[model samples]
Target: MTVREDVHSAGIPVLCQSCEARHRGVCGALDPDQLVALAKTSSKHRVEPGIELIGDAETVDSYSNVLSGVVKLTKSLSDGRQQIVGLQFAPDFLGRPFKVESAINAEAATAVSLCSFPKAAIERLMKESPELEHRLLKQTLNELDEARDWMLTLGRKTAAEKVTSFLLMIARNIDPTVNPTAKSATFDLPLTRADIADFLGLTIETVSRQLTRLRMDGVIRIENNRHLTIDSLSRLERRSGA
Candidate 1:
């Protein structure tokens, strides 16, 4: 039987049985009994776009798994300027472990669903579950790698390449189950053009120009200023200079 089948047959919590986080996220490291223990203190909730899930320097009381939608992570300067630093998708674990406070602002980039557990519960489980700690460590390393790659995007890539790279990143991450060779993808822009500009280090007009250029070149299709469809993922990747 498949691992999922095993998990289900083992009678894990019904809510966890169907969660992407449980199957593909940190929770995947857990056994059925551990899941049951974690679920006893977990809660699922949804937040609308623009809601702050964690504030900069705020006390860290809980951690969450992104069940759906995107989360925008940003850092703010003392002078009140903020920059979009990272984006998290479903199945991505939220919160930095072993930290007393958040270093960045975590806001719902779109309508988001989260399964959250108290910091104490997760930390306790980490001490008891080596696999859980491994999963978290792996995810943290992956994020570091991604952040480095993004530094290349911001510091070296041209305006057009940055925009294309941004779109490709979203298309690739928006759905974890999307086949790597899938030719097409459809999704709404989780961030507005202004936000995209901030993330990509470009002016809003430049971002718009690149999107229009991509559309004119038949690389992607846009609707109502938000919905986007990439007819050819390979083509988009090429445009991204990847």
Candidate 2:
């Protein structure tokens, strides 16, 4: 039989067969036997919004794969102030490998689903699997690129552009299938206006005003203050100055 057939015949674990992580996450690097080994020790769970998944400087014992929903990463100041530093979506690996302690706080921004495994399992697997390490490195580099892009957004973009860019970023990342040419998209506003204001370095009022403007201009539709639909992604992109 062919290699593809051989891999399939090896039998993927039931828990991993349908997992996005198996198809697109770091777990994709693992073969069926390796997957079975990982799945044997992994557990799936959900976290409610506002729940802390990991705290800044906390000892790292385990790692997770984001199964669904958004995770908000933050950094805290000595004065107890916090800044939303990044966001994680489904299929994203949820920890820094090789780090003994976490440097940032990770919280469930929305209702989040996760598949967790002990840190030792992943670290051991990484030592045996170069593909696994490569996948992790690729994700880290992608995050670095995103950080640079966000720096541009925060530092140089106008307030209106920042808001539009935020929406565009969410649209693209929340669903990996979303492309620049997509006609439309829909999703909930995962972060509250106040939280979004903090993330964008704007006031809550400004966020509200921008949403109102987008809705008025037929760029998007809002319902119940949370659910939103992009009426025209191209127009939204233009508004974002991208």
Candidate 3:
């Protein structure tokens, strides 16, 4: 159990000083004293790509905040079919609050770093700080909106529109400060052709064909098959039907 007196007096630990998500994530809602208390029980984890952070239907013992890289949330059928439900990036929270089990599997899509806290400890903090709870609630709502938007992209958009929408989603979400009318933007793709196909509900051949079309149309430039450069945000958005 965390004693309040000890936290206010002891100050934050060395481990928290360099946390990349400190000011941008849920921790930003906490005061220094609360952070000290939270850090006392928190642990850092570095995961490799393809490692499952939480298995579907497994008991939830903890929650985490992504410090870097990407995580893919997926649902699987008993027959081994699976679908990518969502993607979590740095500064995003993981695990469901007040829930005993996970509904989906969370796998590291890239080399990932996280700060983990026991569920009990985090719940205790939430009780004491409504701000923290509000922060989490806000994140949940934003994710909900994104999920709804993605549903439309998957169900309504054409193949070319889907590819464009995917790229625009990556650009817009990867950096919140991405200029809406910038002449160009550059970023590396977190998912491969297979993963992209799975997420977009398309075949790998279709994904490849669309990507090649995007390149041929001069909307985007590709190098090394992963790094992509968009020449015009407006043009991309037009192509994306956004």
Candidate 4:
């Protein structure tokens, strides 16, 4: 069978059990017929962290759902500076709705799993499936809200606050099997300090320093340079004033 056929039949493998009918997918709005149509128009791929997912200002064949891992959406100025615009975790859609046909040069910050869907097929699904359309609308609204919140992180939060918020957000987005808070809740620090710097509007050194401070202050523990463990989540949350 074809890849599309396989994904359609299997559905997304990374759903969270506690909430929502679909995780990291848009199939909640699709009936079997709509699913079949979608199944005919999607593909899956894996990529390591630091690989590029979409090129800047480049159009693509389709959109994607982040099945596993994390994606950092970003842009660069005329100078050499780069800014990570957003983060997309498992069960999240990477592309925008009814906006740009191509990405603005987004990249994966970790080993990522992706489900691709043809834009034409998505448009077709939207037209024929009102539920799918409505679901997509809700997704768009949610994204907007998230963007505004990120703006607050950038504009208002402290270095420790940014790091804490990022860690917490990452924790909440993954599957429970991953156990984000377990015995320190080890998980990959998908984005590098440089990526964090850009995304959070701080210097790379600041990011590094903040991480070190978090570790030293008994707020977190670093493992093998990639996985992060929250030593005292309550303290960290207090740091964020959350």
User: How much is the lDDT of residue 154 in candidate 1?
Assistant: 95
Cα RMSD of predicted structure 4: 4.0
By summed lDDT, which 10 consecutive residues of candidate 1 come out lowest? 1-10
Candidate with the greatest lDDT versus the true structure: 1
Which candidate wins on TM-score? 1
How many pairs of residues in model 1 come into backbone collision?
Answer: 0
Clashes in predicted model 2: 0
> 106, model 4: CA deviation in Å?
1.6
Error of 3 at 81 (Å): 0.8
- By TM-score, the candidates rank as 1, 2, 3, 4
Per-candidate TM-score against the hidden true structure: 0.94, 0.93, 0.89, 0.83
Query: Which pairs in model 2 have colliding backbones?
Result: none
Name the lDDT of candidate 1: 0.91
CA shift of 12, model 4, Å? 11
**Which regions of candidate 2 are displaced past 4 Å?**
1-11, 176-181
Name the 10 consecutive residues with the lowest summed lDDT in model 3.
Answer: 1-10
Model 2 agreement with the true structure over 18-119: per-residue lDDT tens digits: 777788999999987788788777778878899999999999999999878899999999999999999999889999999999999999998888888899
TM-score of candidate 4 against the unseen true structure: 0.83
What digit string (tens of lDDT, one per residue) describes model 4 on residues 131-214? 877877787788899999888887888787987888777766654346555544557777777767767777988888888988
For candidate 4, give the lDDT: 0.71
